[model samples]
Target: MTDLLHDARVSRGQFLRMMGGLAAAAFATACSTRPQTSTPSGGGQATTELKFIGVSDQKAPMDQLVAAYQKAKPSVRITASYAPTDQVQTSVRTQLGAGNAPDLHVVYPGSGSAMSMSQIAEAGLLADLSAQAWTRSIPEGFKPAFQLDGKTYIHSAGSSVIGAVYNKKAFEQAGVEAPPTTWSEFLSVCDRLKKAGLVPIALGAQTPWVTQLITYALVPSTVYAKDPTFDDKQLAGQTSFAQSGWREAMEMYLELQKRGFFNDNPNGTTFEQQTSMVATGKAAMAVQVSAVLPDFRKAASSPDDLSMFPLPGAGDAASVWIPAGVVVGLGAAAKGANVEEAKAFIDFLGKQENINAWAKAIAAIPLVQDASSTIDPAVESFLPFTKDRAVPFMDQRWPNAEVQPVHFAVIQELLAGESTIDEALRKMDEAYQK
Candidate 1:
């Protein structure tokens, strides 16, 4: 039967034999049709096939790269599974409960995601992938976000900046001859743009992550820079999501929202759709990250139409490094059948060439030290600001998970007129109380 499965003529027939016991109609046979005795690609004997599970947001490049890998090794079969970023853990948890899960998926180290994986890791449901060469590429400051007791669980090729991207031309048009380097000047510029018949700022609260971007911009201004001992205080609970200057920040966010700056129905817009608002000049700027710039570049009539400036709260460039955000999460089911092969796939991914390709494809900065290799040219103009002073995105570094979500909820409530600034602050404080 194994030999027959390897035979081209009997491939379909063998699939039926293997899957018939699991289901009826054999139509699902095609789903499991790969030969069990297949040789590994790029080797003498195939080891195992890796099954990947994660968000489909980056699927295009993954597909292209995987196809190239397959061309180089016809024997290995690499299966990629995609789900919404929010759903990846839930899917894995469900499958774990059902005694079935992908060979490799996604997980984060703290709070919402890592908590779920921590149970499995404690139960030994995950495999140790720390030995992979890719682990070496992660920067020193960010290692904790992906690690559990010194073992790493996730790998992202690069990271994105969590700051503001403004239009150079918009400032010129609004009688603001120079980009403001102070928060007061920044708000004044927004008022100018709004008065000039342009939406002062663009936000996509409908997608939720947009709300996080707003918080990301505010984190540098409201927390990290203002508090002389911010990180220490935050870790000690002396400073919290609610106690900081966040109320002022939220008030300011609401003020902008009330002034009709963001898209009228931010909740109705997708990230891509909201990105268009900035790309086409519907809004003078967007509270976004480098992750969205690829979409912006693709949609822009002139890629030059978009450029970035760090949010003004840092007092100066030297003090403002905390606004960079990174996507950190673990790989999938450790005990799944594809562990060895999946590790192989990840190893191939960490190679500088592939990592560089992935970073440039998304217009993000490199996770590895050697960034000069392939930074996207259109976005490269923004790199100098990131150069000596780089910081992990605020959300990733935060110990308490609720802070980010509470931020989005409070902002939405503020926008809906459901809560006053005082109430929002109290709600925020209560949220941090947990």
Candidate 2:
């Protein structure tokens, strides 16, 4: 898996093409029918049941697409459920190990998490999706996220950025007219928001995955913006989290907490509470991925009040970068009885219209776009930076699954004042080596 991951290096040009969208690839619009047992409903019509489990961010699009699929193929009925990242990672992975996983389940891009494509594919638990037409359209730079050993294993609609999802009303209330462009200005804005009696940042550190976003949002500027080859150097054992810009990023993360810029008792807050705080204008913003913009909008009285901006992680606006990576996606279980049926659903998701719908639902940049693709306006501010100023999510390039969970744990400890930056980075470095 390590050799395969190393082989998946993406050049700058290829990365640009990916963000810009690849040429339209032809896909099969005809749905295939398969033999199934007859059901009592619909006058003894055939019925095939497939179960899918995914993270909460996937629910909005999945609900819409699943309904479309069922309408197209009445014989197949999909039952889908959503859960938080930590829960899906733990329970679904256990199900995979036990060989009774759902027909389709959430799979993180690249290889840093237990449910990542490489890790799951390495275990031979993910069905090969290389034959799908959509796989042919995947941009070369993004192959690492969608494929392992040159075989596509997951189906994702597009990429998303991690930024500050802020409430316009809250910002107005704080007398802040615009989003900050530099680190110092960001701090000043936070101070103003805090003084105005609003939580400058709503952080849900108790939810493990939520703990990593602030650092992920900051590291691109502190690390990659200075040395684009930092991941390579770390993989070569020439550098580490402790010795690189990771230290600076960690310090910055802690600095936000130290300034009381985050909501009180962040370590006890859940992602739901954090989303509510920002959506309803109780807080100015939350550092989060663009993929969850729908959730924030759903919780708000007026969705238009929510918009996103790149979280400035550097003193210089030009040096600041953002984390843009493939959104969490689903894969068919290789060992499942309904593997073919599940793969069909993934194939349905690959169609252009379906991809557009999914991307629009999550406010992501479509993996492959055409005239029909509509990017969410909230993320328009981050587009100029996508060409050269963005890096894939840090975990996507990690050598093992251990590093990410360790990252989540250390951040929680730091937020709770139970750990120091040095200690946190040390633990992360140790996990990376493992």
Would you estimate the TM-scores of all the predictions?
0.80, 0.86
RMSD of each: 8.8, 16.3
Model 1 C-alpha lDDT per residue in residues 77-147, reported as the tens digit of each score: 77887777678757767886676666766655433333333456655667776898878667766675566
Give per-residue CA lDDT, model 2, range 1-434, as digits (tens).
55554578866666667756643221222234444533555758668888899998899899999999989998899989999787898899889989889999999999988889999999999999999998999977678899888999999999999999999999999999999999999999999999999999999888888999999999999999999889889999999999988899989998998999998999899999999999999999999999888889999999999999999999999899999999999999999988899999999999999999999988999989999999999999998998889899999999998898899999988888899989999999999999
Off by over 4 Å in 1: 1-47, 71-73, 87-89, 108-124, 168-172, 175-178, 228-232, 258-260, 265-270, 314-321, 328-332, 377-390, 398-403, 425-434
Supply the TM-score for candidate 1: 0.80
TM-score of 2: 0.86
lDDT of 1 at 291: 73
The best candidate in terms of TM-score: 2
Candidate 2: where is the Cα deviation over 4 Å? 1-46
Q: Judged by lDDT, which candidate is best?
A: 2
